[model samples]
Target: MPKLITGGVAVVLCAVIVVHLGLGAAGVGVLDVLSFVAGNGDENTRNVLWGSRIPRTLAGLVVGIALGVSGALIQGATRNPLAAPDTLGVNAGAYFAVAALAFAGVNAGVFGNGGVAFLGGLAAVALVYLLTVGGVLTPGRVLLAGATVSLIGMAGAEFLQILDEHQTRGLFFWGNGSLMQTGLDRPLVVGAVVLAGAALAPLLARSLDLLSLGDETAQAMGVQVNRVRPMALSLAVVLAAAAVTVAGPIGFVGLIAPVAVRLLGIHGHSLLIPLAGLTAATLVLAADAAAQVALPPSAGYGELPVGIVTALIGGPIFIVLARRVITGDADRGAAVVVAQARKSRFVTALVIGCGLLAVAAVVGLRVGDMDISWSDLASVVTGSGQEMANAVVSFRLPRILVAAGAGACLAIAGVAVQSVVRNPLAEPGLMGITGGASAAAMLVILVIPSAPVAVLPVAATAGGVLAMVIIVLIARQLDPTRVVLIGLGMAATTMALVNVMVVGAQMNITAALTWLAGSTYARDLSTLGWLLLPAVVAVMLIVGGRAVNMLALGDDLPRSLGLALGRTRMLVLCGGALLAAGTAAAVGTVGFVGLVAPHLARRIVGTATHRLMPMAAVLGAVLVVVADTVGRSVLAPTEIPVGIVTALLGTPYLVWLLRAK
Candidate 1:
């Protein structure tokens, strides 16, 4: 059976390779490929085959193999079925390192780039390992830590991309995993490293197989469990880094390939390793071939990256698998629990936080290109200020209000989602609500160019709700980790489609990009009005806070306590989605404010949703207002996006949260 399966995969991979090499903008047929190899083809055919098609096909093949083997090794070492480069933060870390190098003008060779990527991936996974409670790795902890790290790394890369868009065009395309190559140079170099990694991988198969028998058992059997696991992981990182260097962090081939191979009943590392590689190569080849036709370069749409196609396909597959992931043991209770505090103290904190937020707002208004003093600001309110002050205040107040309102909405959304999911780490932005809003809004902008600004918030909210519904429906067991993974997949799908839209739009996408980055620059009073929906949603969530509290008490308990688990979850999630959608519409896709504020409020006031919600709203408002202020002031004329600023600020908090006892 194993032999038959391996043979089947190999045959499919070879067929895909041939087809991928033949079909492209140049339209080389199989006959042309054979003829070119026989030295009897036309020069155009030869040029297409040699210059572009062959190299690209080889790149896909090599990267696929590398990613597959890496995924298998990591899964083996971790004893977690969901382990993969992307989910482990390896891909993001590697990509960030390469992007940083490029941004800093390092301009290294292929080997140097691979080395840097390896270091970055290694460091990231090290952090993940260290944060595992008592050094006992669990699937949930690894995934949670990975998601957090990936967010930080991707946010940093986005910041750099935003800082210098023109200089980073090549880097941006590469970051998206373009397989369009002019020559065989990169393919040859990267292919060699991948092949070397693949060769070394089999030697670790015995050690990995033993380690999978659990650390104590393996140790008793005379396996150096600690050394073997680290070595296996190191090799996996090397493989992933090589693939990333060549293909720019293409995702999910590693995940799906190994998982598929395992499901075929081939568990022996010797057979599994090779079969996984063959399967992944087939997937990559097929995705690349489809991409050419999906958005043909010949059609003037430019070739879509193979990575985007793989992500779109892989996302649904991941969601399906997530539905089946065992939920019983994956649960990790709330990360932080604090003693209940006095209501007076909570009230004092809320007042202080709100007051600080107001002061931040005033400070924000007072600064900018043209500064405004307190007296001048007061005069503006009374219609007695200088013309410039009035003009500046008018311009600043709308953006400030939008930021504050969006932040508050998002924070409340976070509180509601975290409670409903019973996961302290839950955030609407991370769970794809914001991404859904952005994608829907982009579609409205592109497809219905006449869409009024007012239509966006409504459209965005609808999209967010739709995405949340899909994610929940896909989740068979409402496991927080599974839901989070499904959400990540949804976000990837929307973002990939959004990327395709941006590429095909053929117009200035500056506004769309700014919004996607969660910026408030040039936002107007109409934006403030969009906050009304979220504000209403916030009120609803606060009113329903008792249900949220009940939800945190596990599934059966809530139902036993006369709380309708399904109905309560649905209501809270809807409210969360509405809030997130409104915020996304108003300020693009600001992240982490929702995540950080709720956690902070929780630590301060305990887990009573009522107290936590209001305090979180205040903190959330303050966070965004301060973030916007810092964003504008940091880069001077070239403003950093508030989304990016929040990410930078929130990442440290996330790390501390992860490490918290």
Candidate 2:
């Protein structure tokens, strides 16, 4: 059966490659390609074949093979079906390394990027491995750790892109994994490396088979488990790096390829390796062909990235995998695992936290290139400040308010979400609310450029509500793992749709990028005014905190206590959506604040929902205020986005929390 399936996949792959090579804007047929190859066609046919279509086809093939084989190695070594280069941060690491080189004023060619990408992938996977070493290396733990590292890598890359928008246009196109090659040089170079890596991979086939028997058994059987593990992983990284160099970090090919082969019941590394390569190649070719025809190169909408197409397809597949029986501790333990504080103590902590937020806001006002002293700050309030200081304060205050308000809103949103889901990891980003708001906001920006500023927040809010409804409906069982995975699928779908809009509309992506990165760079008081609704929602949430607290007792207990469980959940969910929407409207989906702030507040103030709600809001405010301040002052004229700053700050704490016993 496996052999038959593999043979079928091979035939389909060939058919796809052939069809793709002949179809394009030029309308060249298979016969034309054959004639050009046979030296009997005209110059136009020759130019189309040899110059564009042939090189593109070859690049996709090489990329597919590389990603598939690498994914197989990662999953086999990790003994985790969810393991893939993209999921494990290897692809993001590679893309960031290349983007960093470009951002640093280096035009390092394809080879340079490949080398750096290899190192970056190695480093990222090493961190993930280290995080899991003391544990039993469960699939859930490894996947979450990979997700954390991926977030950090992506944030770093986005920071670099924000630094030099003009010089990085090529990087952006490449970052999205476009396969618009003009010549064969890149494919040839990357293909040589991929072939070399593939040839070397089978040497560890015997050891890999043994390792799958578990590390202790493999070690007892005279396999140098440590050495063999690293060797296999290194080979995988090398292949992924080569693929990224050729196709700009195309995601999910590595993931889907191996998973697809495994579903066909292939397990031996010797067989799985080659079959996975063929499967991935076929998937990539099919995706590229679909992308070409869906928008059509002749339609003038520009070619959609094959990466987007693959993501749109792979997300549902991932959701299915997540829902199936798998190995790991999927149960997220304890809603709040911290020492309980007294009412007075909770008040003290909330006061202290709010005080810190205020201090951070003041520092933000005074700490830019032109610093404003306390006297200047007072004088500005009194209308007697120096003109320069007054100007600086005027420029800074609105963004500071927006940051604080958005942070508080997000933190409160997290608290509300975690209450109902009973999972500490539940946040707006994980629920697809952020992605939905982003997609809707981008649509408004591109489709109605003449619309008033007020329209964005309303559109964003409506989108958030829509996404929340979808997540709620689909996650009827409300299993934390299933809900999160469903949300991930929805998020990926929305992001893919957004990418299509960006490429199709040829919109000015600068503002969109800033919003996506969650920047407060040029936000004004009007944006702050829009945050009032979220603030009001936060207050309502806090007032109803006791009902939320009942959720911790599990479903039956809440019902027994006379709480309208369904109605309360519905109301809280709506409140959560409103908070996220308001913040997205104000500052563009600032990530991690919602995830991190609530946890920190729980640690400091205990699990009483009423106390947790306000404490989390204060902490959230402090976090975004500090993040905004650091983002603006760290690089002076070149600002880092606040969203990136939050991710960099929060991911380590999240990793540690996951690693904790």
Candidate 3:
């Protein structure tokens, strides 16, 4: 049976290789390549095969093998079926390191680039290990920590890209895994490193097999468990980082390949590693081939990144894994208890928060590319200002209003979601709704260019609701962290959909990119209209805060209170979805405001949802306004996106929250 599986995968891999080589913009046929090898082909065919097709095909193999073997080793060492480079944040770390280097004007050669990626991946995986160790290393905990780290790393990379458009264009292919290549040097060098890692992987296989039986059993079997696990993970890092250096961070090839191999009843490390590599190569190559078939390069838009196709496929697989994996350990230390209720503190914080928000708006108005004095600002507000001051205020005022409105909506949404999920980490953005909204909005742009302007927010709302419903239905009664893990998978899938639509649009992607990054540039009062629906929803949520408070007391008590448990849960969740989706449609992502603001508010105002909701709204508005001000002032003219700034601010809080005893 093992022989049959290996042979079947090898055959599929070879077929995929052939198809990938044949399918490209140049239209190089197999016959032409064979003719070239026979010394009877034209110069065009020879150049096409040698310069582009062959190199790209080889790159796919190298990247696929690296990810597959790395994943197998990770799963083996940790004895966790869901362990993978992508799931542990290693790929995002590696990608971020490479982007950071390019932005810093470092022309590191191939080996140097690989080394940087290795260090970055090492740091990331080490952080995940530390985070998991703080609590128990459950599958859901590891994945949640990974999701947090990846969010931080990716946001940092995007921030750098926003500061440097030249580097952004240069790293585009690297940001998403692409098989396009200039020559064979990269594939050849990276392939040799991958081969070395694979060669060393078997040395630990015997130990890894024993380690799977638990540390006591492994020690009883005379295995040097500590040394063996670290060494194995180091080798895995080298392999995964090398793959990132060559073709960027490809998602899910690592996860799906090894899992598929194990499911085929081939569990021995020696045979599993090699066969999994073959299986991943087949999957990667086939995905690239499918991308070409779905959207040919000549379709005006450029070629789809092979990562997009793989992510779309991997998303469902991850959801399956998150659902079926034993997650009983997830809720062990995962209670979402807040500070003791303090009425005086809540009132004081609310007054102070509202005051600070007003101050922030005033400060933000005065801190643009050109600052207007206090007297000039007062004049602008009263419509008695100089022409220049009036124009600047006009430009900045609408953006500030939109920012405040969007922030309040996200915070209220967070209160509702956290109340329902009973998880402090349950932000609407993190729950995958924003990704759904962005994808749906992009779909409208791509599919119906002439669609009415009103259709966009409606489509976005429906998409977000559908995404949330899918997550709730699939992960019903599961651990909260497990549900969030599944939601992260859905988020990746939806983002891939957005990337596909953006690539297909072939129009000015600048506006879409800016919006997706959660910027307030060129936004006006017109954009404020999009926030009205969410604002109304926020009011409804705040009015029903007492019912939501009942939800956090676990299932039985809420039912005893005649709260119609299921209906309330769905209604509040859908209401939160409405708030978040509407905000996302109005103002891109603006991440972490939901998570951080509500969390901070709860600390100040306790868990009473009625008091918690309004305080969080005020704090959320203040946070974004401050972020917008800081972003504008940091660089003279290059404004950082508010989302990236908020992410940086919120990442540490998330880490601390998860790691707390």
Candidate No. with top TM-score: 3
* Per-residue lDDT of candidate 3, residues 240-315 (tens digit): 9998998888999999998999889988998999888888888888998898888887675677889989999999
lDDT score for residue 148 of model 2:
69
Q: Specify the poorest-scoring 10-residue window by lDDT in model 3.
A: 329-338
Compare the candidates by lDDT and give the number of the best one: 3
> What TM-score would candidate 1 get against the native?
0.95
lDDT tens string, model 1, 226-254?
A: 78888989999999998888889888888
Clashes of each: 0, 0, 0
| Model 3 CA lDDT for position 374 | 98
Lowest summed lDDT window (length 10), candidate 1:
334-343
C-alpha lDDT of residue 72 in model 3: 92
lDDT of 1: 0.83
Model 3 accuracy (lDDT, Cα): 0.85
lDDT of 2 at 82: 78
User: Model 1: clashing residue pairs?
Assistant: none
